[model samples]
Target: MGAVIRYTTDGSDPTESSIRYTGTVSVSAATTLKAKAFKSGWTPSQTATAAYTMSISDTILFSPASGEYHSEQDVVLSCAVPDAIIRYTADGTEPVESSSPYTKPVHISETATLKAKAFKSGWSPSQTATSAYTMSISDTILFSPASGEYYSEQNVSLSCNTVGVTIRYTTDGKTEPTINSMTYTAPIAVSETTLIKAKAFRSGWNSGTVAEGNYKLRLPDCITFSPEPGTHFSNQKVVLSCSIPGTKLYYTLDKSEPDKKSIPYTEAISVSETALIRAKAFRKGWSPSPAAIGSYEMAIPQDCIRFMPAPGTYTEAPTVEVSCECGIPDVVIRYIINDSGSEDTLYSSPILLSESATVKARAFKEGWTFSNISQGTYMLKVKEPVILPGSNTSVTQQEVQISSETPGSAIYYTTDGSEPAENASLYDKPFSVSQTSIVKAKAFKIGWETSGAVSEKYTIKAAKPVFSLESGIYTGLRTVAVSCETPGAKIHYTTDGSIPSKASPCYDSETLVSLSKTTTLSAKAFKENCEPSEETEAVYRLKITTPQISSDAGGFSCETAEIRMLCEFPDAEIFYTTDGKMPTESSSVYDEPFLATGYVTVIAVAYKPGWEPSDAAVKHIAVKGDINGDCSADMSDVIAGLQILTGTDSAPIRSDYDYSEADLNGDGRVGSAEIVYLLMAISKK
Candidate 1:
């Protein structure tokens, strides 16, 4: 017979010495349990073989922890228990067995809360698991061609990592970009230099930071050579220039390409020998121009017969003199106008050239070969136009007039810096110039060549000076400061109500002007190259001393209390009001002593024509000896006043009445004098 049973959780056979089997055997995982029945010395029964398996419910686990995310999320749900089914809800609701089963990863492109649970066929459902995700757009905007300098026009494109993001942009540098700005859909055409600011926005994501891209598009103009490269019989002066203002020119004389490291051309180049010149132009915020090649061929100088007054333009009729420079004796000089044959006139005196012509001349000696031919091209251009008021001058306004020395010459003008064309505005009469401007005028005639343009610049008035203090009433000594917004301006000021001029006192910015008495300040701003600014005036009225009341605020005993007012300034007029109203200029003037009766409040103020009014002075007067509240001075009131002073009274008096009636002399105290005054007031009553 079996008395006890021994068991082993391992798969080995159970022996007599194996552990005794308890009420229950705990198995964390699948195990084979063997048990045998045994008694004191009896042989152990055959081991009973049994396999056990365990299954424990586990909570659902999310692939990623709950937190904020910048992009879309692919969430995965799992469970520790094998073959357990996981269910989840994305709408912040509890997950049940009837909810959508978790088969694939859940897609979370926006902010949402996901709750899930794990369940099996024969196991209890795990605790509810919760996860929340907050999504936002963190991708920065990208601009094509980046933010850099460009020589030509650019087509800019905008992009973001997000697919459905909208980009707003602004070309103006003042306004910050918002969702309501210009939407970037297609490539933007940037023809000029500008600053582009942009921001990205999405439906359910936060807006991105502003991105700035600065694009510079400037193409420098090519260089131009004066007198054109050609063959000449005299030394030629080659000048390298550019159409754009403030552009620097670099050139090489050995027919090589020119760059920034080449020699800069500042003046005209004297080309005596045959050489090739190449030049390029450079300027800030602009691309370098292409190389300009000019080849100049030089020849011998034609100096045999020289023409006087040079071969240049002149407004008046010039007397051209032709002289022979041959070493031989008895040489003759002959000249001809425009392609005329050799049978021309012989030179005797200077010839007057009233029109444009090319003079060809030669020297001849009877025994020697004929001298080389000399040619001089004279242009006799039209007279230059004259501008009134001159150049580099300043005025408030000017009437601009243009005139030419030659009659019947038409004048063309332009305010901009461009050269005047034949179809430009014709200047027939004087025009009014009220603002700063640059005027260019040119004269043209049908017979003669057009004259060179005359340029003039005029500046308008300077900015008005600003005063730190406004025109109002002030007190005590005040320090005033003046300023001018126009740079390099000088400020002049006056304090005697007079207009300021150059001769007035100049105000230094580092120092402050002081004023002790009432003053009317005037200021003006002036500069060397600008007209003086308009006069600015400010009236500073000093305050007058407050009036003083002659009678004290205590009681006074008489038929009527005499009240007087005084001021420190003798010229100040004192005004008073007895109806408890504020005193003004229209109040009664205290020229002499005034009398007041009954209970009254006297307010007085002092005023002057060009000064601020003084603070009001107040005085309160009560009916004297009226301790019994009868509004009169009598024997019974005198007894009440004596009782108040002696500290033995049957009826207590009102504090306001007691204070006023006790002190009859208005000395701010009550004593024997009050008693005597009260007795005298009773006699008068």
Candidate 2:
């Protein structure tokens, strides 16, 4: 048996609105049940049950944990209790089962809070669950000590605008820094121009955008030149540049100082003559550096010209021509025809050489040195007739008398078939020829052409002897070679510096000429039926040793140089020049080393009476603002200057420096202003 149950639908207790217990009590609608057991009433089971309300389910849990997110996400509500309706709201309001039943997942696309709840017919309202879906956007990074120039040294710091993000950077701005780059842990030292790049990175989130910051902190660098100073070249352009890239360079060419407002250097400037170019650098934020001076020295070379027909003696008239070569387009050729006349005539055409004349030509251009002289001489046929003795004629008499009909004529004869020059022996008196011989004669007269040479045979003759080596100085031991024009003629030579005779050492083998003091050698020829040949001589002057040049180990100053020259040979002469020219025998001989007085190159050579000139020794010296004579003006010099000013112990004084090296203003004395100048020179303008 089962007990019956009764219940009331009103809100009342069991006495007011009673419900009896039955086999089972199920409520499909809103009702309150107060039950008690009856019929068997056994002292009324103490109201076997008091009240029955309703059953409720738990609230739902949303998937995808609540957090700030960057992308879109789905909002799903779930409940552990079965057969419960879950509802969600994206408008950040309270959620109910009937508001919007979450049959499917709710899409959350923007930044909003999702509120969810669960409900059933026999259950109370479930707990509300809310999830906030905030769309996270990466923030742009920030840089401190922003991109600009810094006068002095500075430190640069990097920061991320977004919280909880790290920044990475690198000194090499040319590359992009990734997460593997140097992690920025401390501030960077910006002593020079630098570029800093950084980016923000975080796990489970997109990396922040890359940011860059450039900081320039440096002194104005030195300016540069294309063709450096101390250049004496020509026909070129010069380019001015600065050590700092992209810096504006201004220059002046009119021998004036340069400033920022002067002509800006674009490309290169053409230098035609000597110019003192002064230049300076200019930038927006940097200080104007000291002027960099570049003075260009150039020399225009003269044109080269020459005679068309080489200068030589001619027997007949010929065409005289002049040719010239010059690099400049505007050029002219000036010429003249006299032997001792100015070349003032401009060359127009070729001239005919009808008589003996001298032609001198030279090329010239405006603002250029005149070219080297070009000279040539032309000679015509002689007017005199042939000599009385014809060529290859036979003379029977033992002595033949030859004469020229021309006025003031004189005859010279050679025993061998050789031409008679003006220096040949004069035949003033006729002599007897005891043996057969060959005679060659010529007639010469003042202000008249020479007669034709005549050669006659008197059955036999001998040729003259010729020396292989010319009559000049010879160093060391020399082997003299001698030969005659005729094959069988015996060659004779003398080493005692006297005229040779037929009895002198006959040419049978080699002859060696040793050097002692100045030694002269003479040689001649002799044959059976011919007169003795003319004597040939050579002077031998053997050398002892080369000359030596010496100076102070510290070398010379900018204004003066004292050098000494000495030769091992006692009689050797030393020649020197301070202009860098080679010292020839004709150059100025030095008695003692002298002051150079300016920036110059010193070259010296030594020559003995018969020995060759010694190899030239050269040295070059110059200076800038080297006040302490230490080859450079630097901070050490500044310290020295301060010591000199303060009268420190063991310090060099101002008078110790030379007038040219220490005198800042060329006032012939060293002063505090000079020390100041030296201090300014420390930076090397």
TM-score of candidate 2 on Cα atoms, chains taken together: 0.27
Per-residue alpha-carbon lDDT of candidate 2 for residues 297-385, written as tens digits (9 for 90 to 100): 65324336767677665554568778775555766887878755553788888888755677877777665455667677765434342
Winning model by lDDT: 1
Q: Count the backbone clashes (under 3 Å) in each candidate.
A: 0, 9
How far out, in Å, is residue 306 in model 1?
Answer: 47
Candidate 2 stretches greater than 4 Å from native:
1-244, 267-277, 280-301, 327-330, 337-343, 353-358, 365-411, 415-434, 442-685
Poorly placed runs, candidate 1 (over 4 Å)? 1-59, 220-685
Q: For each candidate in turn, give its C-alpha RMSD to the true structure in angstroms.
A: 32.0, 50.0
List per-prediction Cα lDDT, in the order shown: 0.79, 0.66
**For residues 390-488, what per-residue lDDT tens digits would candidate 1 score against the true structure?**
865444567888999987789999876579989888998999776567889999886578998898887777788888999877864588899987777
